[model samples]
Target chain A: MEFNSRIPIYLQVIDTIKKQLVTGKIPPGNKLPSTRELAVEYNINPNTAARIYKEMELMDICYTKRGLGTFATQSEERVGEMKKDITMEVISQFVNQMEELGYTSDDMVKEIRKRSKR
Target chain B: MKYLQTENLTKKFGSTVAVDGVNVVLEKGKIYGLLGPNGSGKSTFMKMVAGLFHPTSGNMMVQGNKLSILSKGEIAFMPTEAYFYNYMKVRTVGEFHEDFYEDFDTAKYEELIKDMNLDMNMKVSALSSGMAAKLKLAATMARDAKLFMLDEPLNGIDLIARDQIMSAIIKKASEDNIMLLSSHLIDVLENILDEVIFIKEGKIVLSGDAEEIREEKGKSIVDLYKEVFAS
Candidate 1:
């Protein structure tokens, strides 16, 4: 994936892994690639890839087992919460963009309803 | 221990100082990018570090030892241009290194060459530019040296070969080694560099962790390089 130059790369890494999780491409309890493997795949420092895991683990998106590598969290509730959070983030950007385009909340609601009818 | 250190290192060729008063510290386990435009002294500094050229004044230290025979054994440098005898075959070069360097690994060199899909039977003059680049990188990475300096390893390599070469370099890197790669390909190096030192007019113009620099400047390394060297 081509990362944005403006944003920090670790955050972009987190976004990619989270996107994979939410999309079910990497199912819960699945073992993700090791940091070294991630580094090679993305052509990043192994330290940076390790940071990606550390960030995810802090969010409960993934957990590590002693002697074993990291695995995606198996908590359905947490996954559902994450899904909602991602949805809200996208919706926030969309609404903010529409507001800037001279659309009121009511106008957005009507437009959403009309679009939903299709 | 600091993997490599230069104390006001200076190198003068006649009236021109190729590398001037460079002071940098490279620690083990880190991948550093020595970036600059042409004539910025990137290669000159690397050559000094590699012991290919003598400094006119000041000094450098490798593992607390001055630049000497022992330090030469500890540093592996792959210059931009490929240097091989016309009659030398692919495997012959591997054997040459194996005989010359005590740290060279024949098995690893063969494995790398095979992985690179290069024929060991072909003469050095017959291989394509990409193949030769891969061979040079593979040979250097096969060494168990403290530091590896690659000067423009991606100079004429294609996109697919760039990935292959980068992967090889990353594989050889460890917590006990430091790899310093110089390139004008800032975009490609930005992703892999742990630290970056931007040189201009034989001086370090900017030096920092790459991601933090990006966040702070709101610009990519390429953009920063252009801004720094804009003429």
Candidate 2:
């Protein structure tokens, strides 16, 4: 529940749920934690947690039912769709950062592979 | 929506310019820390925004509308010093707020009042510093305002009471509200602040995402204050 300062919190919340999905900590159709619970766990304002949930709903990553909590929305097939979206975005950021650090794509790939092996 | 904004806001006291040329934009549904040393113009700036003091120049806006004498109800400003009529009981303070703020949540006030274990019959003058502070906080949080400005909210409360007050404050933040708190206790607010605005010598010296400032500035906010305000 630790929050990062550099990025917007809503985006982080989205990424956290996405990570949970990929890691199998939370599966499709599983109920997400309540906003108050998340707020207390993270020591964040409840409003921020609510905003995160609202944004996730907008992205089709989650949905809410009246009188029920929010749930992960991506089906097993759509899981791959989410993965592609996240992977491309993450890769773009990594590539840009590596370029700024004077590393080529081959070097970046080599370093990432080395890291993965560890 | 940006719940609050200040345009070239300046406040003067006699010959001294306590606040000068401050421009601020605070979006709704977030918490902001206003950090400054004593006499750095933080209180003065907030006072102007709260309509407690008139700005010598510039303007303050709440929810995209300029704050005027007519628009005071949208803001709830809690001053550092607690004041109430000496003869009045604690319950009277709650009742007063209920009468004043149109959005006052009476049920919430009663619940918080019960949680504090405050005696409704206790007179304001008879209560100790910590008790008075708690009462003030309870009343302030009970209001359903668009913006909440708390100045030095933790000043005199003990550590245990401090935690309770913090939880109370956290509970108050909802999707419809924003909170601006000024405190000298950097470590207490270390993890709570979404963003921090640092003031020095009546001007904004630094302001940004709190964690980014900590990581990039190579120091905690306390250290930054010491360095920036160091003689």
Candidate 3:
């Protein structure tokens, strides 16, 4: 995945995984790749991969089974919440950018609706 | 767990000091990026830790023991320059490393060589600069050392080859060892660094967790490197 150099890499990876989980790319209760595997896959530091798993565990997005491996949360509600969180985040960023360009909320809604029809 | 610690590590060449009273602690289970411009003492500092050059003063401890012959066995160093004989074939080089270091794993060497797409029959002199760099990395990483110090492993390598090299380095990283890579290519190395040490004029100017530094400065490590070294 392409990363923003300005942001922390681990946070970026975490967000990517969250988006995947929300989209069912990583299905509920599915096993996550081992930390080393994640590191290799993303070309990131192994330590950062470990931290990603740890942070996800703490956030209830994933859980680790002793001697098995980490798995995505099976709760549909949690996944649904994550989807909403991501959608809001993207919308807010887009809105902020449009506002910076002097576009009003009405203009944004009108433009978005016009584009949706196309 | 501090795997490697240096206290007032200093090295000098005649009247000029290459590494000035620098104190640093490196822990296991992490990869550290030593970032600096040319002639910033990055190589000098790594050479001292590798035992190729003795510290003019100060003490270095590796895995709780003073830097000595025993510690040397646990440290694998890949210098910036090609150290192999031009006459030697790639296979001979692997055999050579196996003969010298007890930690060198011949099987691992073969695997790495194959992964890097280097032919065993190819002569060292026949390889391109990029291929030579890959060969050096494969040879050095074949050893299961406690500390791996690679001086500019990414230098002279192409983008695709760089990804291969990075994957190899990532595979070698484990909880029981510390990997220290020195490279001025901050953008390339930033993602894989657990911590970053910015060196200037033989001294560490800034050092901290890579992510924390980004969060604190609100800039990328590349930007930070430029800012730190800018006159």
Give the best candidate by TM-score.
1
- List, residue by residue over B1-231, the lDDT tens digit for candidate 2: 677788889888898989989989888767889988788988888888888889999878876677865567878889987778887888888888888889788788888877666777789999889889888988888888888999988888898778777777787776678889998787677566778898877788888876678778667676777787785
Q: Which candidate is the best by DockQ?
A: 3
DockQ of 3: 0.83
Task: Tell me the lDDT of model 1 at B11.
Answer: 85
> What is candidate 3's local distance difference test score?
0.93
Quote each prediction's TM-score: 0.95, 0.71, 0.93
Worst 10 residues of 3 chain A by lDDT: A1-10
Candidates by lDDT, descending order: 3, 1, 2
Tens digits of per-residue lDDT for model 3 on B6-100?
99999999999999999999999889999899999999999999887889999998777798898889999999999999999999999999999
Model 3 interface CAPRI class: high
- The whole-model lDDT of each prediction reads 0.89, 0.80, 0.93
lDDT of 2 at B168: 78
